[model samples]
Target: MATNSTVSLSMKFDRTSILGSGGYGVVFRGEWNNKIVAVKRIEKTNCENNKGEDALQKLHHPNVVKLYHVDSDIDFRYYALELCQLSLNQLFNGDEAQKNYQEKMPPEKEVCLQLAKGLAYIHEKGFIYWDIKPQNVFISVHPTDVENVSMKWADFGLGSPLNDRGSFSTTEHNTRPDNWLAPEILQMKENFNRTTPLRQEGTVKSDVFSAGLIFGFYLLKGRHPYGSQFNIPANIVNNTPVNLKAIEEKKHPMHAIIMDMLKKNPNDRISAADVITRIANIQ
Candidate 1:
């Protein structure tokens, strides 16, 4: 385990080998214990108020990105994680998006199953991954066969453990509205003001909805289920009807399963475990 402080602190990462950067933090391509890895560097201030490190240390699942080590200095905290070259979003919008899609890297069913398994594991461990989007789903591709890719959940900065009641509340943090955000979360954005601040309780079911949207996006070939780009957040917040006719019309095997996951009410959505079971039955 990465929890061993001595092993974690001894690891070294190249400052110039940045793989990605965003509001959350910067990820650097690095090596640990003779294996290639990604070193995620975040400010100590963030981790001080975050449970991501705690959650990552306890979660050990094949479907989740493996944390090899944890290192830190005066200003920042560094986490060495399994290196994944591509994200689910990259398959649809990267410069090589069209090429990747043509190659059909990792078939649709496999991707969905892998995602479900990862989320199921996270929930089983009593955590709510508030950030469940295509960008957070990392993919490791084979050098020869793109179809032989592996998917894993990565970036647990917004993740937190569920309370005794099976839910967690966020008073104010890094959460933001996005295309894949669940309706309940989007609704929070509506009431979020400078004075009132942002207070919301999130459950595993919210993750189920976001996961369903990701499946829909992949199956729909990058199209969002909630109308178009401009109105997506609003539509979700308003609980507007989802446009699933494309899958429904084609009678896609996962159509009904996804439909239930996207239900307006959180209680109506199926569990991540149920998703795995349903997918298994179809196969």
Candidate 2:
């Protein structure tokens, strides 16, 4: 069990600091039992998982951060998780370091190698990490003398159950962060009505497709081959499928491997082994 200094109801955990935030919830650095911990609390009136406490308990991995315990929304409750100092987002986005990420890019081949290792680990267990954005990956729960470029998949809030095709469940989030989402996620756009049933079911290939996108981001200076923040590039919107369109237009030699992974047809997206094999060649 991880540490949790109890914070009473009607008492807001002293928000010493804020970690990172996303659509699911915001994270804060708090003190409990006189010790530091990360408190993540999600509020959804119809949220079946509430604070995701149960799902957090089931995931145990060396690279994945540990969840101490949860303080449910039973009474304006908050979840208490292991409080780590920084996320890849912070390390890469902070003032002193922001320039580093902006100017000096890390070896794309090396980072892809590391991701391959993590992806392989999760896939072997029949699990698909539906979300694999840089924000969801973290390093060093605590530091050691030696330098280790180790990273673990941290957020399982969107974890998918393998071998359970017959089962389906509905959780909120009628909308998601579209930047990192794969093409299929927008499956029901053809329907003008928002209430129409949209198939958001995740598949292993979807994970692979997302991996290709991340690889594209890394190799292309954080550029989403599909065109992102600035505009969804002209070439991408013309005829080619959104996911593979930008990748296809690139004349870069290395992009060939990445293009294959970005295939719009999820069934054609590269597998975990294919990613490992192709990514290993970048060096």
What clash count goes with each model?
Answer: 0, 2
What's the lDDT for all of these models? Answer: 0.80, 0.57
lDDT of 1 by residue, 1-283 (tens): 2332323455667777777876778887777778888888888776786588888888999889988888787778888898887777777788765345537566678888998999999999999998888788888776687667777998647789999899988776534546888888777766766455577878999999999988888788777888898989888777663677888999889899998898889999999999999998885
Listed in order, each prediction's TM-score against the native is 0.90, 0.72
> Number of the top candidate by TM-score?
1
**Model 1, C-alpha of 252: deviation from truth (Å):** 0.9
Best by lDDT: 1
Candidate 2, 218-266: lDDT as tens digits = 5655456566554442333231334444545665444776667667776
User: Which regions of candidate 2 deviate over 4 angstroms?
Assistant: 1-13, 31-36, 44-47, 50-55, 73-77, 82-94, 98-106, 139-142, 166-171, 192-197, 230-254, 281-283
In model 2, pairs of residues that clash are 5-32, 5-33
Q: What's model 1's lDDT at 236? A: 76
